[model samples]
Target: MNLNLRNAVISNVSGNTQAQLEDTIVDAIQSGEEKMLPGLGVLFEVIWQNADRKDKQEMLETLENGLKK
Candidate 1:
C-alpha cells in the first residue's frame, strides 16, 4: 500500500530527538519499508530548515548513506 510520506513523517517524528529519529529511519530503510522512506525527506527538510549548516550537512550525508543501503 502507498502512504502519504510527508504527513506520516511529520506525525511519527513529532517528539523524537535527532539521533533517535536517525536510528528509526535507518531501521525502516533496512527493513525495506517504502512507506517510511519518503518521510526521511520530511525529516531532511525539517532539519535543514532548523539546523546549523554543519549539522545539516552531517545529517544529510548520514541520511543519504542510510537510504542507499
Candidate 2:
C-alpha cells in the first residue's frame, strides 16, 4: 500500500473556499483527535511556506508561547 498523506490531504481540500477551510480547521481542532494532526501540520506547512518573514517570526513566537503553558 503506497499512500501519500500530504498529497491526499491537499487534494481533499483543494477547491475549498476560505470559509470552508476555516470550518475544516476549526472542526479538526475541536475534535481533539490524533489523526487530525498530520492534516493540520500540512496546513501549517502551506501557511509557513507562504508567510512573510514577520509572519513566520510571529508564528514561531506564538508557538513558543503556546509551549510555555
Candidate 3:
C-alpha cells in the first residue's frame, strides 16, 4: 500500500511495456472492491522525480492548462 512497495512491485514488473502496465492498472481498477488509491500519488511523485527537468516543467504546464478547461 505504500509508495515504495508499490514502486518496487511495479519495478519488478519488468520492461516499461504499456500494455502490461495497462493490464495491471485495469486489474487494480476493476477489482470492484473497496481499497485505497494511495499508490497513485506516490507513482506521480516518482515519475515527477525521475522526469527530465524540461519534461517535468512541460507536465506541470500541461496539468495547469488542463485545470483551466
Across residues 13-55, which tens digit of lDDT does each residue of candidate 1 receive?
7898979887987887788877666766677677689899899
Task: Assess the local accuracy of residue 12 in candidate 1 as a C-alpha lDDT between 0 and 100.
Answer: 78
lDDT of 2 by residue, 32-59 (tens): 9999999999899889999999999999
- Clashing pairs counted in every model: 0, 0, 0
Q: Say which candidate scores most in lDDT.
A: 2
Off by over 4 Å in 1: 1-5, 17-19, 56-69
Better of 1 and 3 by TM-score: 3
Candidate 3 residue-wise lDDT, 1-69, digit = tens: 465767776575558588976776677668754452544445566678899999999999999999999
Of the pair 1 and 2, which is ahead by TM-score?
2
Model 1 per-residue lDDT at 48: 82
| lDDT of each candidate versus the true structure | 0.78, 0.93, 0.70
Best by TM-score: 2
The alpha-carbon lDDT assigned to residue 46 of candidate 2 equals 88
- By lDDT, the better pick of 2 and 3 is 2
